[model samples]
Target: MVVSVKRDLYGNGRLVKASDLSLGPRQCMPSSQSTATSVIFQQGLQDCGNTLQMTSDWLIYSTNLTYSPTPSRNSPIIRTNSAVILIRCYYLRHGNVSSNAIKPTWIPFSSTISVEERLSFSLKLMNDDWSAPQTSTVFTLGDIFHIEASVDTTNHVPMKIFVDSCVATLSPDATSSPRYEIITQNGCLLDGKQEDSSSAFRSPRPTPDRLQFTVDAFRFVGSDNSMIYITCNLRAVAENQVPDPMNKACSFSKSTNLWTAMEGTSGICSCCDSMTCATAGQSRRFGSLYPGHSRIGKREADPVKHWLLLQEHKVTTLGPLLVISTEQSQARTVTPLSSLVQLWVVVAFVSLSLVILTIFGIVGKRPFKLHCRKAGLK
Candidate 1:
């Protein structure tokens, strides 16, 4: 059988037909045997190519590479708190039977693959007053709230954000009907895209063209204390090119407002694909290979299709869970304790002095009169 030998040496390798070699090994070889070798090389090229493909897959697998989004290409590598590298060393030694043989039959290959790190996007409940991302906070009734999704342009690839579905539960129980109307959604768009002409934005608008975008800036007037669960779904793609509308993997109706449940028709937003569905989980996961610089050109196809490719596509959910409590207005009057005590003491002293003076006049005046009369008679 013929087999084709292929090697990529980064533009340094070459191929030579054995027939063209004038080496002593070729000279000693018989013509029929050399012809048979050539035939084998010619006939088994397809099978050899298949074998190489399988070998490459295995090599990538051994490196522990993952497809989740992660820091790549000169960006500062910020690993998850749970992230750790596994080091394994193998040792081998052998004595060569012949000097003509290659010194080593195999070489070790090492690669860094980030594992178990999830959720490339971050969800923050924006403080309207401070305009900063907040993990947990308290909100009162009639408070305008904004939920922001910040994508790390340095570490992660940018994608589209949609206010998938939001429900405010009056109680912690899952069976409660989530009121979607209490919190009204207004502004949501892709970064660099045109803003809503209605000028309905209540929260501070995000800086344009940045990796970050507001998933939904909403105002929730709480009629009662409840938990607000907002699910913001992201459709992250590697290539900037948008696929044909018909071929989109995920979609939703344009008329159906994302704040509400997915309806077949009559919603405000549309053109959603099948991949666009509401998902709920405590936290999401993101995975990517480290030292991505080494494998740049090797990724020709989109990362969505190949697990080893730069992890080109990621669909993650940034669900910002918030609690809204009813604002109670209790009137409290604060009095100065020092001034009040002084006033009470002064009033008591004046009353006591008046009582003593009245008693002295009533008793001592009569006694003095009687004594004076007795002295006169004597």
Candidate 2:
């Protein structure tokens, strides 16, 4: 009996196209009417056409091509020759190109990516000349101050930049000033220098590696005697080899935090409470990068969390704090002197005045005596 069997077509693995695989019948034993059997199989292959592929082992017989043979009641058959499928991201489903194909599975990159490799930034207070202040190191209320920021080469691909101001210390009234503001924000690009659009989402130009801004101390505080902390937050991304339009290239992979300090003291009364910080964009090189797609918004990240994570991430930069005083405070002598030195200066001044008075009294008496003698002689 020439028994034939057709294997099951459905499988769990990825199926290869007939062109990718070399398909041929398994060798069979020579028997009666072998030519007829071959002709029947060849006809079936032709009917299936170019699209059909033989993945599993199939048996052919002259007795019946369509008939499915079951195991004899006395004998059970164990069949083996299953196909292995390797599912890939580029495969087309059911030979349909119009329909969306299998998408590449994205695995989240290591959240522990080193901050240095991802992005870096710095904050500096500059003078009108754009040079570091030499004499006026402290920021005074009403004083026009300039600030400069530069990012590391790795993190120059930022999508948004933010400057947040807050009172680093608790006030006597048990209140704290913490405010968040967007300095430069655009969907996938940085704000242009000349663009006047009020919308924070528009980017008329490319992002720069360095940026600058000018701020008036009094205007920033609205009121005086508070320590202010300004931090820079940057949202950055990393990309993959293959790009797609149906979805983003990749999600935001890094966050960079750079900060500087300023103090608003009573002498230089500040309007920090009422005054807001100033911002500007400088020229820097920018490359095409993936747009931000994280659940975290541009300005919605928790300040407390960011502050806490700075230490954990080991990404914070330390620098001296700039003191901001009101014009009144600057005029007042805040220099401290030793009590002994002050007392000694007072005693020395009193002694010098008394000596001068005694000398004048002696000289006047001598002159008067001489006049009396001359009159008596006359």
Candidate 3:
């Protein structure tokens, strides 16, 4: 993120020069913070460098206000405290040169910055190239659906999102009955084991916040031409954490003779064969979709519980994707009528009615005229 200062920012009726402002730990003039040069009267600072950002390369950084200790990026934040990244930029309106780079008359200008904590989740259906969203929701049997599930916490800490479970249901409610479980037991791809199935995750993920997968489309055996909604349970963790059995996406690979993970460390996928990848004794509790809690780093007396914070999760759904067989699709196509076709049908009916009425009028008049001629002859 870019940090900038205005040129005309004045103190005591004097303009603040660019070199007078310093950022980072020392707060010394001409601060040597590499994180992009501070914007000012140079290179159109009005556009790009007007606002100050609190992040450097996606990680939040902070500088001390009291001490000249080195700038640190590591700090613990809990529920008691706000999730703010403190930054201090020294603007020495009046200072003197000294043996040390720091000025004795330096003044500290501090700003408290915090990222948004709210998170949003969604599941999307993509087309072949994954470049665009699928326009047509109708899919014939044996077709494939390219799915992407993600969590969005725009300015919050970076997180690695995982699809804990994915099940297709006729209803929007994920817990509904007559469900077809595709990915279950905390990221195991059950459908991937089927014969001739191409269901698995798209490897080389673009980001940990999004997961891509392909599922061969099909409907419930007895339910044909039905609407199916795919609801997936997605969870997220800190990006720095490692992918464990519960948080990794695993797919069965027939060619490799072992289960594989998209995030690597295939050893975590070994239990996928037995469908026991979830943590021991932690069964999926449908009693509550959101069982645990939202606050991640609570200030608890129990240290162990603090470190083992519960990850955030959301149940995101995408579909009403029409599932139909080839025969059904063909029948629907033949029976469907466009507005133009319907308008033509109405026009034809009106014209036929007018022709029939004209013919009847001519026939009735001819009979009357013939009778009148007979009477005249008599």
Query: Which candidate number maximizes TM-score?
Result: 3
User: Per-residue lDDT for 279-346 in model 1, tens only?
Assistant: 10101111232235333246533333342232222323222233334323111122465568999999
**Model 1 — which ten-residue stretch has the worst lDDT?**
56-65
Cα error, residue 208 of model 3, in Å, equals: 2.1
TM-score of candidate 3 versus the correct structure, residues matched by position: 0.52
Between which residue pairs do clashes occur in model 3? none
Model 2 per-residue lDDT tens digits across residues 237-262: 23221111111111111231111111
TM-score pick, better of 1 and 2:
1
Residue 91 displacement (Å), model 1: 37
Tens-digit lDDT track for model 3 on 1-378?
A: 244444333323333334445443233333244223232222221232122212112211223111112222475432121111233232322322224564445333211111335455667778899997676777898799999877665645778888888999976567888898999887888889888788999987878788899999888878766677787888877887676676788888989768898885887787776766654213332122223544433455443355335467777666567777877777767556566689899999999999999999999999898998989953
- TM-score-based ranking, best first? 3, 1, 2
Per-candidate local distance difference test: 0.32, 0.32, 0.63
Q: After superposition, how far is residue 189 of candidate 2 from its true place, in Å?
A: 18
Among the numbered candidates, top lDDT falls to 3
TM-score of each: 0.30, 0.28, 0.52
